[model samples]
Target: MAQLQTAVSMIYPPRCTTCGDLVESDFGLCGPCWRETAFLGGAICDACGVPLTSGGKDGVFHCDTCMQDPPPWVQGRAAVIYRGNGRKLVLALKHGDRQELARPAGVWMANMVRNLVSKDTLVVPVPLHWSRLLRRRYNQSALLGAEVAKNLGVSFCPDALLRRVRTPSLEGLSHEARMVALEKAITPHPKRGHRLDGKPILLVDDVMTSGATLKACTNACFDAGSGPVRILTLARAVKEA
Candidate 1:
């Protein structure tokens, strides 16, 4: 296996996932791409995982948006802010059919949410409607979630949540409108829903914008008796002030 891998590497050297530049490792960004990416660090909100200006007095923190409209999940985290190379990586994985990006993205998410994991934690991905799934040929969130579960050594329920309604594109919609469009659009899967009962759930996604989708997924888990749900995403879209 090692010899075959070496032969393959020699034949086709590994390149950066973002830029086409060669990198020493596989499934990663080049140095320039790495530095340009807005990987989240320092203080962040407990509810939405948006970067905060400062840490909280008591170790728990939430951004103003989260404070005003709290999310359904108990905690949240993100690997990067949605901009520059971070956004590029998310879009590549989500729409460019770059499925290999899931490995590194999932590892990043697992590391970000490491403190939240437990023996009974079940990793789940936000679902796509059947129509979208058929059109896209894959649910990017599920790939990320599966990798996260593998890295974390936890159980994964890819179908724990089902999208009952296919809503239109959420772009250009106000947060309120997005919420209305997603209301009850997601629910616990009848057959797989039982796996979520009383288990701590780690909800995974590629990007979090208005968070309406993640909120709906969290509520579905709650409806199925899921315990203390937490969310993790590859990137979080930060709104301009």
Candidate 2:
């Protein structure tokens, strides 16, 4: 097996996940692309994981938007801020059919929320409507969530939540509009909902923009009797100042 693996690597050297540049490792970014990626650090919003300009002496801090409209989930963390190479990674995994990216992306997300995972934590992903799932052939969120669960050594419930309604793309919608469109669109899966009972949940997603979809998923987890729920995303979309 070791000899076969070496032959494969020799035939096809590993390339950067984002830019297709030759890299020394598999499922990783090259140095230049890695430098350009906006990995999150410092103080971030407790509700949504957006990096804040100030750390706030109190040790706890939230961005103005999260303070005004709190997220449905208890806490949130993201591996990267949505921009530059970070955005490229998200778009590639989500739309460019780069399913293998989930491995590294999930590892990043798991590291971000490592402190939140418990022995009984269950990893769940935002669900896609049947039509969308059929069209896309796979749910990006589920791929990331499963990988996170594997890295964390926790149970993964990919279908714990189900998208009941087929909603339109919310790309250009306002926050309120997105919420309305997603209203009751997600529900706990009838057969799998039992897995969430009293379990701390680690909700995973590819990206968070308005967070309306995550809000719906969190509500479904609570409705299914899940314990404290936290969210993790590959990237957090932040507005420019």
Candidate 3:
């Protein structure tokens, strides 16, 4: 058995999923690729997780956008920005064959939202429409949420929320337009709403581009009686002005 295992390992050696560098484990980036990924840190927004780099002292700070127009979710956290190596990793997971990255990405998200996770909390993924799911094979958000939920020792409710309506792609759309497109697009599953009631829902997603999608999902959770919906994402794009 040992000899056969060694032969198989030699036949299919693990490589870094991002840059294809030789690494000790699969689904990782080489040192340079890993360093290039911008892992967000510092005094972040209490609402949106935008880093507050202005001259204010180190403490809880909300970005100007979030301050002016807070999102529906109680708070938000992200592992990185949607640029550079961060974007590469995200694309690899979503488009490229890097489903293996979900483990590390989910672990990072779990640590970032550690403060908000509780015993009664439920990790809920923003759903993909049936058509999208069929094409993508699996929802990246659901994969990440399930991984994080395992680490948190809480329930992972992949179907707690459903994307009942399918709309055109939201890329390059204005914030208002995106919101309009997602109007009533997400809803808590009729039978699953009871499971969500009174539970602190940690909404998970792959990215927050403009935040309209997350906002819509948050409304669904709240409308179904979930308590204090907080958000976690692998990456986030600062809402366009």
Candidate 4:
């Protein structure tokens, strides 16, 4: 079985989905490419987990945006900041058919969720609309959700929330526009209320930009009777001027 797998790999030449370089091992990222990722560290927002630019006087760190209006999710954690190699990796995974890249990224996200979430929490991925899922061939958030659930010994529910409409890409939108767009895009699953009663939820996603998407999803989950939602993502984009 090992030899057959190796033979298949050699014929296929497994490559880093993020960088398109031949993978030196099964780890997905080449050594140097791995070093380029800027994982979030040190003081971070207690609500959204974006690295705080300055510490708060009360020792309670908060990003300026979070202080203005806390997101619907109770808290969030991200594996890395969305810049440099982290941005490239997420884009590749989402649009470049770099499905294999999800492995390492998912594993890292799973570890983070495991540490933060309680054992009984249910894991749910922020869902993609049917149109987007068809175009992408996979929901990156669901892929991460599955890995997180497996490693953490929690139940993974990919259908707990639904995207009711396909909105325009948020790439160039202002934060307010992104929030409005997401508000019109998502809704609760009909049956999720039955499944979510009294359950804490861990919401998984690929990357967080302004957190509008996650916040929308969290509201849907609450409508479906879920308890407080905590968000986990592979990357978080820094606030830009």
Using lDDT as the measure, the top candidate is 1
Give one digit per residue, the lDDT tens place, for model 3 in 1-241.
Answer: 9899778768887787677878776566688877888888877787778766663445667888887898888888999878888888889889986788899898888989887778889999999999999998999999999999988888989999889998899999999999999999999888776778888999999998788899998999888888788999999776434
lDDT of 1 by residue, 10-116 (tens): 99999998888999988878899889989887788988889998758688788988888888889999999999898888888989999999998988889998877
For residues 1-241, could you state the per-residue lDDT of candidate 4 as single tens digits? Answer: 9999989888888676556699866657777777888888678887787887686767658888887887888778898889989999788888888777777887777766566788889988989999988888899998888887887888888888889888889888988999888875787777764676678999999998878888888888887778789999999888665
TM-score of 4: 0.87
List, residue by residue over 149-169, the lDDT tens digit for candidate 2.
999999998899989999999
What candidate 3 gets wrong by more than 4 Å, as runs, is 1-11, 55-58, 239-241
RMSD of every candidate to native, in Å, equals 1.1, 1.2, 2.3, 2.6
Cα lDDT for residue 65, model 2?
80
The C-alpha lDDT values of all candidates are: 0.91, 0.90, 0.85, 0.82
Span of ten consecutive residues with least summed lDDT in model 1: 53-62
Preferred candidate (lDDT higher): 2 or 4: 2
- C-alpha-based local distance difference test score of model 3: 0.85
**Ten-residue segment with the worst summed lDDT in candidate 3?**
51-60
Kindly report which residue stretches of model 1 are placed more than 4 angstroms away from their true locations once superposed. Answer: none
Q: How many backbone clashes does candidate 4 have?
A: 0
